[model samples]
Target: MDEHDRTRTPVAGRVEADDRPAPLPRRITVGIIVNPKHSATLRAYADLVPQLQKAGAHYRSMTTSVERSGRWQAEQLIDWGADTVIILGGDGTIRAAAPVLAEAGTLTSLVPTGTANVLSRHIGLRSCRHAIDHCVRTVASIIRDVPTNLRGIPVNAAEFRRADGSRHRTEFISLAGIGGDARAIAHHHFATGLLGYTWGAARALFVVNFTASTGATVGAGDTSGTEGSASGQVWSVMASKVARPAGPIAVFPQARIDAEAFTVVTVGPIPDRLIARCRAWAGIATACLQGRPQAHPLMDYRCTTDMWVSVESPVPAQLDGDLIGDCLELRVSAGEKKLLVSAPTT
Candidate 1:
């Protein structure tokens, strides 16, 4: 789309002045990657380009289609000399572009324009315009003042090898799952479009036997090494970096952005009772909203750097929010890589 097609009327909201002192010099080059499949991609482009131009920053924009891989497009933008890359899409879109940005070792910004904006929620950025403005201003000020040590949190990237011997890499700012959760994701994918997550949750209810095999080992540790135990009849396994996955799902309530390790939540086999499941769901919801430090009998939380998950039979697995088919052996640990991201100041 042309400049006219990309421009939109700025929301008539007041721009709050930053409390930090102004910088002396300001010059920046910004690139935007838009996922056309996202519901809010068009609106995000319209709302952000004008703000970038008005701020006197050089900008480039590209739209992502199924034919064109998000990672390839992001790499092209970085090669085109983007000091900072801004992405407009959901968690999946971000996952696609993250490794590319991280490989380039560039500071990346995000505009939450997808169904599950988990990363955006974690960084406290509410909208596309908010993220764009924050990125532009931060870059400009960095050029002017050399004293600011403002930096983005580094996050772990995960790689999932499918039962078919194919591997896919994804970045998860929220949570990843295997077993019942993976099956739920697959069901969700088949049942609905972007809104399939609701259907997935419903499917989880009718299905009592979601795990392919209960006897398996779930390993977890840090860059130091992996440590954990084996459990039989695994229900749901979640590894999270942030507190809330999306909405009210707080599987890891004590997770922090700057923590040296990640938290794993594994649900062991239990009686398939509605009341028990409801209680577990309630605990997750309450922890997410109230920041309470409580644990459920079905759920166990452990902190570690590396983890190995082996199932008795082939089970569905997912990285970030994307399904990775089925797998008998899954090894997940903090990869020796990191992503640079922009976050709002507290």
Candidate 2:
């Protein structure tokens, strides 16, 4: 038998003869979550919903504002009997619905609507209408032979308690930082509308400084795995699900989605020379774009299941893409895999 024949299974989860093709559904129900604040996202959905309907698929959308809408969206989608969940926002939006979808054992699709669709790019999904069309076709093909045991990867979701006794939850789909990157994100959040992140990153480059007294202990695979030592005061502690760290940055290229663990990349105290810091950033960017792991003086990469971070003083923490408040003691652990749809390999 050929490879395709070997992999063939009936849509109803039964093994059938090679000559018999599994029946495809006439109408597949999909639940969509949209970011109301993003105009581009609204446009994408306006185009996509009509296309899906024309293709004989039913699309249900939940429009949301900045308020916490992910959990409610997931509940509604499941209640609507959606076969799959489609997220039309950025990493933060995706991260918001991931745990719920994962627990429901439903497949999740990304539309790359946010400003920095970093996770979408990392998974080999291009950012545009063409990519959306490709994703739709792929989902159609898989409907018949829906894998019984869908694979999910572990991700760390951090909970932060503020000094005022209030708690907030942040999910990190890519990388989460506690110092420099955190400050950059915070600055970007508050800056003027135009070129906010760019300006914030630039300001962070000049203002952020680190010393040798701060450090973090990372636990990989089982949280109890071998503990690694710190070289200098950890200016930032990054826990990433994807190999690429975030944005135009890529610190650990060896990390893979299917890897049984997460990559913990730590940077020593801030470098003395500005040029060295720039070089480090450049190195990481190169690694991410090229899909290769590169070594640099300021960074150390390792795989772990659990990580315990201790900072000399409280500092900001971020997950996925949003910034939580300051944390003096932080514990990170790997969670179960969440279902994600990706482009089919040719």
> In terms of lDDT, which candidate is strongest?
1
Question: Candidate 1: where is the Cα deviation over 4 Å?
Answer: 1-26, 142-151, 155-157, 165-172, 189-195, 210-226, 273-294
TM-score of each: 0.79, 0.78
lDDT of each: 0.68, 0.66
Residues 1-346, candidate 1, lDDT per residue (tens digit)? 9877874545457443553367644677888888888556788788778877777778888888777747877888888998878888877777778778877887787888777687778877876778767766666665565432334454566666667767765565556678777777787766545468778866764455444332222334323333446656667777777887755656577776555566877765645788876776666556546655345566767776555576666778887677778876565556455667777785
RMSD of 1: 11.2
lDDT of 2 by residue, 183-281 (tens): 777788655443676676777765555532323334443444346555346557776777554455455666676565667767655655889877766
In candidate 2, stretches whose alpha carbon ends up further than 4 angstroms from where it belongs are 1-25, 142-151, 161-170, 190-194, 210-226, 229-232, 247-249, 272-294
Score candidate 1 by TM-score against the native: 0.79
